[model samples]
Target: MNAQDVINFLQDNPSFFEDNPDVLTQITVPHHTGGQAISLTERQVSTLREKLAQVQGKLSELVGFGEENDSISAKVHHLTLSLLIAESFESVSQSLYTHLTEGFAVPHVQLRIWNSILKRPLPEFVEVSEELLFFAADLQRPLCGPVQQAEVQAWFGESAEQLRSWALIPLRRDAQVFGMLALGSEDAQRFFPEMGTLYVERIGDLVSAAVLRHIG
Candidate 1:
């Protein structure tokens, strides 16, 4: 019989090996590593071992991801505590920069508030393009990917050319977007399109609260 026919027969007859016990022991398959021919049972055991190893490898990868998420969550909590103690708008900005750049390892950050009600504003309250403000308002979630907004990219100063990826988060006041927090990274894969933005969104809300306390 052909190889396919034999495979079909074995698959169709589940109890064939029990019925022909001698034939099961007598059947030989080539060794996977180019060694001597091994019995069908040895090959089956070897295949199971390989599958188990693959499953173990996948489990270890998942464990590594879990540990990474835990570490990031701890960092976010630390940022939240720092923001809580902030007594001024500048204090809030300083704490955010320290936490994101030092604690979270993000290198470039730019914050621009277009709708602040303050009579006098620092560099943070600079006027931006109407189009940029509209774009920020359109975002339902934090946008993560290659840099798309040219006007926002110019806000990074000397680091603008070096940045390969970006995360744009809208800061909301009164459920309306009034500002944006831009984070830039040199690594192309740092802020990929598919990356999760849960922590990013929380950071945006924290910054919004801090800013709104003084200039809402």
Candidate 2:
């Protein structure tokens, strides 16, 4: 009979193995490694071993990711507590910048605010164009990847030219976006389109809330 017919017969008669147990030991299959033949039992054991190895590998990878995420979450929590304790907008900015640069190893960070009343003039109070304001408003989430807009990159000053990647987070109070936080790195892959933005978005939210408390 044809291979399919034989397979169908074997499936249809599950008791055939019980009826003739010798056939289980006598049947042979090609070894997966390609050098020799193996009995059905040996082949089955080999297949199971390969599957187990794959499952163990995946489990290890998952565990590594879990540990990394836990570390990041702890850092975020610490930063959040620091920001909440900051007495003024300047202190909040300082804390945010310091933690990001020292704790997170971010090379460059820039904060800019527009259309807000500042009690004292700060570098972050620099004028932003209508185009940039519109861009900030349009962002529903943090933008991460290679810096594409020259004006946006210019916000980082002299290092702008060498910055290889960026994460742009729009800072908003209620529904109105009034500021932006730019993070840059020399490594091109530091921020990429495929990377998750959950932590960055939460940072933006925290910064926005803290800054809004000071702005008129």
Candidate 3:
């Protein structure tokens, strides 16, 4: 009979192995590793071992990812505590910059707030164009990738050209976006379109809350 017929027969008769147990031991298959023939039992064992190795490798990778996530969570917690202690707008900005630069090793950061009423004028409260304000308003989440806007890149001053990648997060209070936070790095892969923005979104939420508290 043909291979499919034999397979159909084997599947149809589940008791075929039980009826002739010796056939299982007698059947030989090519060894997966190299130039040798092995019994069907040995080939099955080898396949199982290979699968087990793959599973182990995947488990180890998952554990490593978990550890990395835990470390980042701890850093976020520390930054939140620092923000909590900040008493003024300047202190809040300083805390954000210091934590992001020193704790997270970010190369450059810039913040610009639009349409905010402040008791004292701050550099962050600088005027922004209507286009930028619209762009910020349209963002549903943090934007990550190469800096596409020249005006936004200029906020980094002399380091603007060297900064190859950026992450822009809109600072929102209620339904209005009052500001934007931009982070930059020399490494092109530091920010990418496909990268996850969970932590960055959280940072944005924290910064928006702190900034809103000081706004008049």
The TM-score of predicted model 1 comes to: 0.87
List candidate 1 stretches off by more than 4 Å.
Answer: 1-24, 32-36
Could you give candidate 1's per-residue lDDT for residues 1-216 as a string of tens digits?
899998999899999989988986798999999989999999999999999999999999999999999999999899999998998888889999999999999999988887778724577788899889889889998999896789999999889999999999999986799999999999999998999898899999989998888776
lDDT of each: 0.90, 0.90, 0.91
Model 2, stretches more than 4 Å misplaced?
A: none
| TM-score, predicted candidate 2 vs. hidden true structure | 0.92
Per residue, candidate 2 scores C-alpha lDDT tens digits across 1-216 of 899999999999999989999987899999988987989989999999999999999999999999999989998998999999999888999999999998889999999888787645778987778888888899999999986777888878899888888999999888899899999999999999899999999999999989888776
What is candidate 2's CA lDDT for residue 89? 88
- When summed lDDT is taken over every stretch of 10 residues in candidate 2, the lowest stretch is 114-123
Is candidate 2 or 3 superior in TM-score? 2
RMSD to the hidden true structure, all candidates? 2.6, 1.7, 2.1
Top lDDT prediction, candidate number: 3
Colliding residue pairs in candidate 3: none
Residues 21-127 of candidate 3 have per-residue lDDT tens digits of 89989999998777879999889998999999999999999999999899889989999999899999899999999999999899899988877877457678778
Better of 2 and 3 by lDDT: 3
Better of 1 and 3 by lDDT: 3
